[model samples]
Structure formats: structure tokens, C-alpha cells
Target: MKVVLASASPARLSVLRAAGLDPAVEVADLDEEALLDGATGATPAAKVTMLASAKATTIARRIADTVPEAIVIGCDSMLHIDGELVGKPGTPEQAAERWKAMAGGRGELVTGHAVLRTADGGIDRAVEGHAVTGVRFAEPDPAELGAYIATGEPLVVAGAFTLDGLGGWFVEGIDGDPSNVIGISLPLTRKLLAAVGVRVTDLWESD
Candidate 1:
């Protein structure tokens, strides 16, 4: 079966490729802020799951006729700290502030994954799930924090940090799947696909 990634995240793409799957990319055009505002969920997991399902369903509906046998996957991530949901900081100053607040503290990184199988202009199967990881940050000095912000990597990622990039050094530890912290969980994705009666290995690209 053909695999489609309904996201524009390079980290997610890299993860899939590293797992030997070649997926076609068709980013969903979503008003994320508006969706978040309208979402009704009691926890981070529920919210992210809703968003991921929306993304997958939107893309699947659009491409179902063209790629009827495709398995579309959508993912979203957020950091929950101090009873708040945190997304991309969008600025160096905000990133720096986030780092300061996160230093020596622990937060939950939740990533939602949704899989939709398209068939004959509709969805044949679907499943949505989420993975959460507890992350502890190492206390960084002001200079180090400022330097990391200056690198500009944190501004575009959830929680203003990354586990596979420059921000990795400041992450002291993770309580669960590290890949989920990077925006997608390979193992979780595999399980979700299986739940929908699709084997992850079946989506691997031909050699």
C-alpha cells in the first residue's frame, strides 16, 4: 500500500524514512489556531487526537479518489506544562522565556497519530491515538539559553525545543518514547496501523 504523510514536518518525514518507509507528502491546509480554539477536550491527549484525526480525514477526503489505496497519516504534538498547552513559541524572545521556565522542570510531550485508509472516494478504515512522554530539562545558564534561541530551531518546534536537533543537549531525560517527543512515534504508528488492519512493513517502499 502507498503511504501518505498529511503533514509538512521534516522531523516526521525523517523518522518515516529512517524506518525504511517512503511516503508521499501532501500537507493539509489547516487553520491550526482556529481548530485549537474550537476543540473540546479535557486533556492534551484528547485535543491532539482530535486535531490529528481532522488533519488525516481532511487529506484523505481530498485524495481518496486519486490515491484510493493510500494510507494517510497525520500527526500533531504539543507540550503540556503547568496545566497549559504550549505550541511553537514563534519568536526568539518567547523561546528564551520558555527555556527559562522549563529549566530543571518536567513536562509532558504528547503526540497524536491518526491513520486513514482511503478507498473509492471515502475512508475505508481509520484509527487515532496519542503517545505521551515526560521530559526533564537540564538547567541551562542564561548565555546557553540565549545561544540556543539564536539558532532559531526552537521557534518553529513545539515546546521551543527538539530531541533530535540543537535543543537535544538541554533535555536531561525522557520517561517514554523519545520519537514521540520528536513529533512522531514509530512504534505507536505501527500499532495504530495494525489496529486498522494494515501492517507497517507493508507500506515500506520497494527496494
Candidate 2:
């Protein structure tokens, strides 16, 4: 079976490649802000999972004919802190403001995963789940934050920080799967694939 990733996040792609699976990228084009705004969900996990499912299903339909007998994976990440859920900061000022409140604090990084098994130009099975990791932040000095913000790393990533890039400098620790904070949760993905009757290792590229 072929493996397809329905996301445009470099972090998510990097995580999958590092884990031995070389999935074909199929970036889903959607108005994410509109979806989130109109979405009805009581919890962060639910909202993220819904978004993941939408992405997966959208791409699954697009490629089901060409990539018959394949597993499609979709993922989305968000940060939950101070009773609010936040995605990418999207701007320097917003990034800086988020970091100001997040510094020396803790937040839950939740990643939603969805897997679809396609057969005969349609989905035969689907599964979805979510993972949450506690991220403990370090207090970077104002100057350090300004420099980091200038790099523009945090502006495009969830939680306005990263675990595998410049933002790592201010991440004190993580309480769960480190990969979850980076973007996708390996363990969760594995289970989701299994739930869809696909073995993750089966999708690994042959050496």
C-alpha cells in the first residue's frame, strides 16, 4: 500500500521521513480559519480532530483513483493554555505577545491525527485520534525573544514555538511524546493506521 500525507507542514513531513516512512505529500487546500470559526466543538481535541478528518477526507477523495490501495494521513496541531486554544501566531507582534504570556508557563500541545484507507477510488475505512503533550517553557529575555521573533520561526508554527528549531532554545521540557509537540505523534499515528487496517511499517520505503 502507498502512504500519503495530507498536510503542508514541514515539521510533519520531516517527522514522518525521520521515522522511516516516505509518504507522498498532498497538501490540502482549505480555508482553515473559516472551518475553525464555524466548527462546533466543546474541546480542543475535538476541534483539531475534526480539522484533521476534513483534510484527510478531502485529499483522500482527490487521490483515491490514482492511489488505489493507500493510506492517507492528516494531522493538525494546536496549543491549549490559560483556557484558550491557539494555532499559528501568523505575525511578529502576535508571536511576540504569545511568547510573552507563554514564557515560564506550561501548555498542552495537542495534535490530531486521521487515517484513511482507500480502495477503488473511495475510502473503505477511517480512523481518527489525538495526542496531547505538556510543554514547559523557559523564560527567554526580552532581547532574546526579539531576536527569535525576527527569525520568523514562531510566526508559522503552532504555539508560537518549536521543539526542533530555534524555538527549542526556550522550551524547558516536555511531558509526553516529544514528536507530538513537533507536529505529529508517532505512536498515535501508528494506532490510527492500525485502526484503519494498515500497518505503518508496511508503508515504509524499501532500502
Which portions of model 1 miss their true places by more than 4 Å?
205-207
True-structure Cα RMSD, model 2 = 1.1
Best by lDDT: 2
RMSD of each: 1.2, 1.1
What's the count of clashing pairs in each model shown?
0, 0
Q: In candidate 1, what are the lDDT values of residues 51-157, reduced to their tens digit?
A: 89889999999888887587899999999998889999998988988887899999999998999888887899999999999999999898888889989999999
**Model 1: worst 10 consecutive residues (lDDT sum):** 198-207
Writing each residue's lDDT as its tens digit, candidate 2 over 1-207 gives: 788899999999999999998888999898888889887565899889989999999999999888768888999999999999999999999998999889999999999899999999899999999999999999999999999999999999999999999999999999999999999999999998888876777667451
Could you tell me which 10 consecutive residues in candidate 2 have the lowest summed lDDT? Answer: 198-207
Tell me how far the alpha carbon of residue 47 in candidate 2 is from the true structure, in angstroms, after superposition. Answer: 0.5
Query: What's the residue-level lDDT of 170 in candidate 1?
Result: 95
Q: How close is candidate 1 to the true structure, as a TM-score?
A: 0.96
